[model samples]
Target: MNQLPKESIIKLQSHINKEVVIQFQGGRQVKGTLLSFDNQLNLVLDEVRELPSQRILGLVICRGALINSFAIDGMVEIENPYI
Candidate 1:
């Protein structure tokens, strides 16, 4: 993978107080808070957001869960909660 530009990294870090959609290996997708991320690319999420009515996931964790995705989550919209 090519290195992301510093500007993009800064932008992502600044947008921490947001929700993100994560897709797992089995075509499951979920939405939740982006609590934290480590240098190794692991994510700690919390208070999972309301998911799409059309999609159903096998599991959900409110406090937080570790997620490993192929890429950083896209722009998310959160109505409540401060990052």
Candidate 2:
């Protein structure tokens, strides 16, 4: 085949799991593994870790309310078996 098969190629989906740091419009920060997304470009993240205290934060608002700006760190490059 000149191209790839049904599942031979890895698809990054290129949606929510795009690894991004969204600065919600509420003056808050969110960091997590993109769990899912919606048509409105809203994200459902898993393994989420919040800054300030490095604690886990649940679902949050995605409105561009208090947002100043956002940034993407990048894919995690470390592997520590013990947390």
Candidate 3:
């Protein structure tokens, strides 16, 4: 079984229980509180809501393959190792 890199795990761990915005393929997006995630980047989120419309979705398990990107609800400055 391939394991996730330590840095990735640490980054995700910091976001647990925090509000996040997940953008999916085809431009769909949602906001929710991150509950859990796996090596594949698949996520379990609570209090999920669709973006723009703000429709309540309650809870969701999102497949990593469909995910385009993830953003914390607020500004987060990631250190740039090369800079």
Q: Which number leads on lDDT?
A: 3
Instruction: Tell me the lDDT of model 1 at 45.
Output: 59
Q: Mind giving the per-residue lDDT tens digits that candidate 3 earns over 1-83?
A: 99965555336988899999999999999999999999888999999999989999999999998998899865476899998
For model 2 the TM-score comes to: 0.49
Candidate 3 off by > 4 Å: 1-10, 74-83
How would the candidate models be sorted by lDDT, starting from the highest?
3, 2, 1
Query: How high is each candidate's TM-score?
Result: 0.46, 0.49, 0.77
Runs of candidate 2 with Cα error greater than 4 angstroms are 1-12, 15-18, 58-70, 74-83
Report the C-alpha lDDT of model 1 over 1-83, residue by residue, as the tens digit: 99964432423465465667766655555676666655544555565543466443433442213443423457455587764
Q: Give the best candidate by TM-score.
A: 3
In the range 44-78, model 2's lDDT, one tens digit per residue, is 66666676566877655454334454455643556
**What is the lDDT for 4 in model 1?**
69
Per-residue error at 28 for model 1, in Å?
Answer: 1.3
Higher-lDDT candidate among 2 and 3? Answer: 3
- The lDDT per prediction is 0.52, 0.55, 0.90
Global lDDT for candidate 1? 0.52
Q: Give one clash count per candidate, in the order shown.
A: 0, 4, 0
At residue 43, candidate 3 shows an lDDT of 97
Candidate ordering by TM-score (highest first): 3, 2, 1
